[model samples]
Target: MEWLPHAQRLAREVVRPESRWYSAVATVPRHTYVPRWWEADGDVWILRDGQSNPDAWLKNVYKDTTLVTRVDTCHADTAGIEGIGIISDGTPTSSSTLPSLVVRMYRHAMIADDHQILVTTGTGYGTALACARLGSDHVTSVDVDEWLVNIAQDRLSLMGERPRVEVCDITGPLPGEYDRIVATVSVPRVPVSWLQALRRGGRFVTTLAGTGLILTADKTADGGAVGRIEWDRAGFMPTRHGADYEHPADDVWKGAMEGEGEATSTSRYPLLYPPDAWDVMSMLALTLPGIDYRHSQDGDTRTVWLLHPDGSWARARASGFLDSPAVHQSGPRRLWDELERIRHRLNREGALPVYGAQARVDPEGTLTLSRGAWSMTVN
Candidate 1:
């Protein structure tokens, strides 16, 4: 119980004032749902349990981090009973998503106190927060996994609060009309069923699959919705059909770590950490949806690769500290040049107009972005 005070302090100081809603929600004991978990180390998953080391377990459980709760829809508690050294290489199916990202998502949703909310129930921690802020009667949580629904019910009961926690696939028609719908997972596109379930003027917040962009839109009178990105970045696991994400091609990212190119001159631009934060990556993804990026760092050397479904490829490498980077690219179109174009636009325009950009969604699910006279449409 002593840890509760410390966790609350961290949530308030490190998370709350900084606008991290997930961290405040993390004050709830994540270890309750994740008494055992499997950590990913490259291609392998290692199981860690509460009984193994008390101090280490406590440290990890409350560190404002996300813990993988299930792999391929198989809960860790069941998987661990088999034995140790059992490798589960399947993709992560469910998790207590990181608190900072969760909070960022909620902030984008802009839930009002009296709004009726429908939220995805994974660990139920997010559900608890909704109930804490907006009252249990105002929140309805759903999960496709019945076990999770039951577990969340029990946990909510333990906290002396009750909301309608049910087993329903969110990809399909939801049970009730809601003023705010916040999904903790990503979706390929906004499902029409969600629009059918939303009240007029209701707002929905979600992320696009395969990218870090968050989509926030308000329901419109004509049965569609339109909203723009907030001034933030977030990513989440894609929405699942049954219980997990479809397996990605194993060889898709294979051999990317080999770093097969010559060292280049230092780039004019300073090397960015977590290259996804770069505006170029976001623009590239918007312009070309299926392109994938991989980055690796070893000592003083850094390499970035861009691969496309059409076999177009680009690689950039830098050795030591340098300003102007040598770039190597080959494909239908020069990828580095495209990045340079985006960067140039960013510099000349002083900002890439993504956040607060105008969005219009048609009833047919087409999304169009409009800024000034320039526009891009996504189907």
Candidate 2:
């Protein structure tokens, strides 16, 4: 397969020619790590096989885009020929992260040649890139799924680079200490285990679940870590303890989708998809954590729903982007009102406090995010 030129082009797009990671980006065969992947078409996931169409495979593999290799617990590599139809259920569990984002995470770590790094193994493509730059001995990769780890190790060995790949839950006790620990998966909070595994003064970089905040911190002397919410935002799938993520109960969503809540009002602002706005979503998550955001469009109308596990729900319907959404709220809390308060803050201050906020993780894994006088403690 003539894939070197494509990789070289990808390298140029993601890194400078003089950068240490440039060669790794230019040389690693990303396609080898993702022979088959799931591509989304509207609400359904369609399987794409590289062997069936080499041209499309090269196009997707070389592009600076993420490819979902596993949906729920079903890996595309093992999905066989029968898994080509539209799959509307379940969520993506594993993916080959975009090359640029992988490089961005590595850059955040300020990885030195001598620094040992622990990274997550998704498609093993990121692991391969790390091995190419820092050598297999300096890199250690871990994944929760045994099959994922086994296949990744085999691929790494085939490339003549065998790093330590283990089937371990990254949120739990790590296998060893390292100078840098970078997680491509987001977590609800900084795990105490991560702090314990990091060598003193080591750096850690990862995203927070339910938000698009990329946090970068350094281990402090007191067995804790201090850092800031980075201005650059990236979102990754939240870490799971088992084969798949535990979704909210169906009854919770039922109220949000069907019921006319206890209160109804017209929103002062237009309908905004929370996920599409990183800062807004981050502030909402910080203020009212555990709100599940959902949105759908029918013809010219757009409807947004916010469901909480505590039975609180909110729905907003708008005919146009600039039109005021008719909002409804139910349960013990006024969820839409809370969202409006956030929007009001943004309108009044021109910015949200989530980005660039100071972050501190206690030894017990509690995280506090503060900006100016505003503070939020996440346990």
Candidate 3:
């Protein structure tokens, strides 16, 4: 099947025709990088083989949509043709990010002709796009999974491209200095290794784990960095040290799901899924880091739970869209009250302080984000 026209259509949808990145998006065969992928079906994952349905493959591959390539330890490629309808109990580990977002990220990097860039190698599609914009010699892609690196390298080789593909953890020491560092994966904080590996005055763009923040900063002469949280927001899976993410114990989830709380009250607002609202999620993440969110529904009733590692928990339930939830809170902090406070602030002030906040990173990778008189630090 002819896929060039579809790629061109995607390019037009993502970037201007006059944009320098246009040709790369217009020409690269995205289908080659993603011959198989995993699609979400309610609570389980359904594996898709492109060869099985060429039309569906072209329809999906050329669109501006993210395609999940790996779920936990299960890769779509390794899954057999009969792997359709496979029930996956794990979260998405890697994916071919949507084309528009990839272009936006590269635009944030302000990559120049001579700039040497380090990017994430998820499905190799993003890396391929980078190589298309800058020569293969100017791009380097890295991943924590050796298999991913090896396969990405093989795929790139098929296109007569040989950018540096390595299997080192991105959070650890990098192999070389770069003019720009762009990560599609989110990190807890600015990795110290990234600070050291970026040349002075170099710029890096990344998102923080557990928040929809796009932090773009530059290296400083003093060995630290200074920049700001961008007005644009994005979210990515957090960096993993191994093949799979370390999930909270089942017992911990049970407690958050079923355990009684110390306090109960009527919530100020209707039941809202915090994560569905980017600003609310970001503000909550900034105020209370590592808070886990869970939701469940039974017929007419809907329940949402917020769990923090600090032993704080909040449960809210409602039956209607406009119904105020009965909120229960427990532990050292009143998690629900804090969430309400953030919402109240947004409702009254019109915005959260996290957007376009000034950012400063100490030499040790500590980040301080301040807006107006509000300041928060992440170490």
Candidate 4:
């Protein structure tokens, strides 16, 4: 379609022409792979088809935006008109990640010529770009969903590019070893199997689950890996073992948000959700894992909820600008106080050292992170 040239031109604006990947981004027909996809309008998800609105479809594909192709296994390709429109009531399960972010991850990989690579096959748009830059023979892509793998393989074949696409859980045994591994999916921690599959001296890039931190590290001789967190931030859906993600028990969620805590106090700082602040969010997630954050607003009243699986939950509510938050802490730990402590520590230092920090993974998936005298571990 005529969209290729326009997409190439648009990509040039974001991905420099001098970049080795520019040509691949310029040539690959991304719209074909996302002929049907979901787009969120307000709080509802709506389906958009290339054949129905070719112009809007072309505009979307060429804009370097992510296209949602699947919602909890209800593939857009097969979704029929339901309710009043073509919509699905499922959370996004897979998408063609934004092209700019896709290339940005590749840029972090610092891939060298002749380096064999393994990458996640989301919508195959990124895989097509990779195959165009590095020959199909040197690139291997995988996805846990067999249907996605098959669709991507066929699409890539139609484009006259062929990469070994496999259906396998990336967290488990890899299809093969390579010098570079880049994942668009977030992992809770560095998977030990990745350590086993990576060739010594090979490097990998990924985002930690529940945060925007992007990490890149090389395999070490001790079956561990060490690297630095990139200053740039990116977030992705965590890899799914099945069609949907498992949620915390309904009662656990209810208690965390509504139940009373053992200790009640006022917060030094106003209520804030950790995910809103890139600087402290990663630090919070790394230091204390398994905390789910939620934010709600009622007029001037803003409430933030921090719920943990261990029956520990914190709720902070504030009104107006910069008002002190009424903090409630219950269960085994005081989470709101912990948030204040973390924020205070970072505020005292002028900035958190998450960027350019040294990251080390032990043999069993324990991540030891340190920058200057500040250090934290996540298992």
Better model by TM-score: candidate 1 vs candidate 4 = 4
How badly does each model clash, as a count of residue pairs? 9, 0, 0, 1
lDDT of each: 0.73, 0.91, 0.91, 0.84
Higher-ranked by lDDT: 1 or 2: 2
Q: Judged by TM-score relative to the true structure, which candidate is superior, 2 or 4?
A: 2
Encode model 1's per-residue lDDT on 308-343: one tens digit a residue.
Answer: 665455666777546354565554656566666777
lDDT of 4: 0.84
Per-residue lDDT, model 4, residue 124, is 92
Model 3 stretches with alpha carbons more than 4 Å out: 81-85
Q: lDDT per residue, candidate 2, 58-171, as tens digits?
A: 999999999999998889888865544457865899999999999999999999999999999998999999999999999999999898999999989999999999998999
Structure candidate 1, residue pairs in collision = 21-103, 266-323, 266-324, 266-325, 267-323, 267-324, 267-325, 268-323, 268-324
Question: Which lDDT tens digits does candidate 3 get at residues 1-379?
Answer: 7999999999988999899999999999999999999999888888888999999999999999999998878888887644544755669999999999998999998999999999999989999999999999999999999888999999999998899999989999998999999999999889999999999999999999889999999999999999999989887888999989876533356666766778999987999889999989988987887888889899879999888877788899999888889988888899899999999999999998998999999999999999999999998
Q: Candidate 3 at residue 144, lDDT?
A: 98
The residue-level lDDT of candidate 2 at 266 comes to 95
Question: What is the TM-score ranking, best to worst?
Answer: 2, 3, 4, 1
- Model 1, stretches more than 4 Å misplaced? 14-27, 40-44, 71-74, 84-91, 144-147, 167-169, 247-274, 321-337
Colliding pairs, model 2: none
